[model samples]
Target: MTASHGNEIMVVSGASTGIGAATARELAARGFHVLAGVRRERDGDAIRGDGVEPVILDLTRPEHVRALADRIASDPRHRPLRALVNNAAISVNAPAEVLPLDEWRRLFDVNLFGHIAITQALLPFLHRSHGRIVNISSVGGKIAMATYGAYAGAKFALEAVSDSLRRELAPHGVQVVVVEPGAVRSEMAGRGAATANDLAAMMNPEQRRRYGGLIEAVVAHSLAFTRNGLPSARAGAVIADAATVRRPRTRYTVGRDAALLTRLARFLPDRVLDRIAAANLRPYLPRQGT
Candidate 1:
């Protein structure tokens, strides 16, 4: 713990990599005591720094979640947690019709349920400090595209939960904010591409005959899009701002693409948006009956 680690504490989930890691570094640089939650001891060690305290936190596991809350509550030197960033999430890409129910459940387990569970566990500390809760969402939260349905669905639910939480916690002076980002450079994009390929590879003969090539092309396009995304550090800067700003907005759009797509979602009709989105897949769409 650094000199300032005693007074103001910020807990960031998924701090081992990507935006979460960058946010931990940024907040520590800004003089806030950052408790970075990672899944492994090695990850915790990797993120340790001047004002950052790395702790093992695996959202999918109840014991891990409980231990984190207990550790913070028991520590006399650390109290009144100022912020909680729910950034730990997994991306599973597949067409909704072909996606397994188990995968859907797993996605929600980490992206939605895990977030709610952690927030409930930490509510007491947050109330003591009138703290903020920043939920990391995505443009997919606003617009659902083909092949990314499962990921989008989880984000959509998160948006709804954040809305309800914000209103419910208003009287208690706890701010609940949603940070919707567009394509930001991170491991998630690469993982998404790999998952897409894996899913396609796992398809049965009939399923592969129907959608394999299309899935491969979509994954390639997704990888390219990710390659052009904003840096993770840029997103971290926005998250840090959202956490510390005196009067933070209820929702902060992080990337240029995020800002534009969110606006387009609001203005465009569903049918129009659907057509625009499908245009990209047109080339890869399989011919009828093969």
Candidate 2:
């Protein structure tokens, strides 16, 4: 076993499941003291282990965020913060016009503003330690599909925020990295499908006529993409590497699909990308009226 990274800490939010859970475990395995963030006591209990301490953290909750900051600041060990992985998110897929404004706000609340809240709170400690910040993004961040406006909107905004923050923090010895994973097999696929269907049911007749089939296609496509996606453990390792590497890249793309999609987004025109997206979704579209 490698020597322990005594008193060095890594903070990972959304550690209850999926990539967040895996990344928390991976960091602990790598010898860093990991503060894993979950939303409930039961989740915390489930994830607690050697070198891993689970904290109740729901990003949308102000009290929870403040409590975490206080805990870090007052730690008896006074561990230096090595990295902060912002991984909490909600997966919602619906047409732009069909998803209510409240839903859009909710998505941004968890996916974007929550991360910002955590980042802003911990930045003081990070500046003291010159630690890294890893934002978990997605392929959707770079390319919005037919029904991904809200989800991608937040991610795309995150990408832009990471860019500006990276430049702003570079001079201060902090490094900001974005990890865009195409798809990693996780519970999110199922949850997202449910969200999509729920939203589809609520759509007005005209809106359903326009987008009902499209919503079904997106859910099916999401499930298939996750089926072929990277394993959460592998994705976690990639993220751990991003957090701990001495000379980390500004961004890391997990899985071949992420690499391919990001590369295409960089080079392809909108029309071409549209056709490509349509082609991918074509197989999943519902057949007309049975």
Candidate 3:
């Protein structure tokens, strides 16, 4: 264990890659001691260096979450945890009707429930330090679209939870902030595409016939969105700001698309938004006969 310098410590989950990894590096660069939570030994090794301590954590597993809390609590060299970044999440893309209940539950397990569990376990440390909790949500949290039902639903719930948590923890001086990012370069899009493909492959002929083209379109759009999206580092910077700012906003919207779309969602009618979304998917829609 590294000796404590009395610098505030921050816990960033899903630090193995993407925004989480970027945030770990950014925070460490800013002179904060970062406990980067990864799921695998290899990932821990990958993130080792530059004031970043890699901790193996699997959010889906309660034991791992508990162990993390216990380890932090018992470590003599650590300062009280000053920030918690709930960045770990999984994405599943499918039409609402065909999407399995199990997959939806699994998404929530990692993105919502696991996050809540970690927050609860570490509240004592956060309270003691008068710290911050940064929840990584999405533009999907504010706007729901077809084929993204599962991911959007989870994000939506996360936003709600963050709101409640922020109000509840304010009296204790523990700030809860939501970072809503639009499409950004990250492993999530690739992983989501892979999962969608796997699910498509498992579909029966009838199922494929009914939904295959739409799924393919959604997956393709997702891939393109990530490819052209803002860098993860930008989002990481925003998250780091949310953690360290003297007076942070209730929510930080990252990326131009995220800001624009979220704003449009607030003023635009659903019927108009629906038409725009449908038009975007029109090119990929299956032919009338085929």
Model 2: how far is 89 from its true place, Å?
A: 0.6
| Residue range 111-169, candidate 2, lDDT tens digits | 99999999999999999999989999999899999878898999999999999999999
TM-score of each: 0.94, 0.97, 0.95
Q: How much does each candidate deviate from the true structure in C-alpha RMSD?
A: 2.8, 1.5, 2.8
Residue-level lDDT of model 1, residues 123-167, one tens digit each, is 999998889999999999999887888889999999999999999
Q: What is the C-alpha lDDT of each candidate?
A: 0.88, 0.92, 0.89
Report the lDDT tens digits of candidate 3 across residue range 1-290: 12233377889999999999999988898888898999999999999988799998888888998998997798777677888999999899987777789999999899899999999999999999898999999999988878888889889999999999999999989999999999899999999999999999888899898889999888888888889998999999999898888888999999999999999899999999999888878876666785
Ranking by TM-score: 2, 3, 1
Q: Can you give the lDDT of residue 49 in candidate 3?
A: 87
| Poorly placed runs, candidate 3 (over 4 Å) | 1-6, 286-290
Weakest 10 consecutive residues, lDDT, candidate 3? 1-10
* Superior by lDDT: candidate 1 or candidate 2: 2
In model 3, state the lDDT of residue 283. 78
Question: Alpha-carbon error at 282 in model 2, in Å?
Answer: 0.4
Worst 10 residues of 1 by lDDT: 1-10
